[model samples]
Target: AKDNRIRFYTIGLGANQMQVDSILGPITVNAPDDLDEKILEKLANESGGMFFRAKSAKDLTRVYEKINQLEPVKIDQTYLQPKTPLYPWLLAAAFVLLLIIRVIQWR
Candidate 1:
């Protein structure tokens, strides 16, 4: 994920520090063990991000909130679609012209 301008907030489920370290960026490892301190200390040092160990549901919620805070999404623009039915009007006009033509032919 390079040169894409999109930052990643990876949540590694059941991954060890040795495995998470091999990856780049802010990665939260939700593993069985808490995680090695040496790895956690150096996690932000190299990638300029934080490493969180999600042990429970609350931890996972906090991690998601942190990620949202880091990368806040904003809508750039809004598009509106006009709601109009023109086909019925066109059909009505055609029927009126046909009726006029029939009256002229009868006269």
Candidate 2:
């Protein structure tokens, strides 16, 4: 990614263990045990990016906002020219020319 100038922003969510109420009773299970935070951190570090942990929706929103602030999109404003309607002027000119032609024909 360094050669291609690509960045990676990694995010890990939820906890490793979760509890659920079952008919038998309360059971403890693995929630995001498959998610390896160390791999994510290594990837972010290698790609020159950031690693974020979001436990809830609010934290995810904040992480997104921080990423936006860190790397804001750049738009080219050089080609922003205001558009002027030429059809209106062309229609007026055509009407004036038609009126003049009719006046000459009548005379």
Candidate 3:
């Protein structure tokens, strides 16, 4: 979001509505686990996009092919780095603790 040279093209996300913008649900039926289909639908319509639901391998492939055919979005991905330098240390501590416990029990 911070990048000025980027456009977002989110697709097939279960959390979002797949209204007119999606390429999977509008034309076909999806599986039971298809989450937030209505939301995606609403989002697509609101965003002035198309929505599609791919229930099978062929449909899924078709969706991808369709997506590829669309115009390219001009945006660069923002590289996010973790602020916690202690993350690696925490992992090491956990491994050492487990090793010490196993060694003590082996005696």
Candidate 4:
């Protein structure tokens, strides 16, 4: 990624343990411990990015918002111009055509 100038933002979600409900009752089991946060953090650091830990949906939303704010997209305004409205002109043309048709029919 460094050679290509690409950055990585890593996110780790959930806690060490999670609760699940079964026929027996509510049970607490170990969460997925296979997620190596150290590697995620290292990748973020090496790629000049950030590592975020989100325990809930709200935390994940906040992390996404933070990343969006950090890397904002720039738009070129020079190519933008005000829209030219042609509706009124088209309406007038239609009115004139209707009048001409009405006069021809009357005659």
In candidate 2, stretches whose alpha carbon ends up further than 4 angstroms from where it belongs are 16-30, 76-107
lDDT of 2 by residue, 12-75 (tens): 9985666789999999988856789999999999999999998778989999999999889998
Q: Pull out the clashing pairs in model 4.
A: none
lDDT (Cα, tens digit) per residue for candidate 3, span 23-60: 65454333347466677776665655557776456767
Specify the highest-TM-score model's number. Answer: 4
Q: Candidate order by lDDT, highest to lowest?
A: 4, 2, 1, 3
Q: Which segments of model 1 are wrong by more than 4 Å?
A: 13-50, 76-79, 85-98, 101-106
* Candidate 3 to truth, TM: 0.36
TM-score of each: 0.49, 0.58, 0.36, 0.62
lDDT of every predicted structure (CA atoms): 0.65, 0.90, 0.62, 0.91
Error of 3 at 46 (Å): 1.5
Number of backbone-clashing residue pairs for each candidate, in the order shown: 0, 0, 23, 0
lDDT of 3 at 35: 65
Q: What is the lDDT of candidate 1?
A: 0.65
lDDT (Cα, 0-100) at 107 in candidate 4: 100
Point out the higher-scoring one by lDDT: 1 or 4: 4
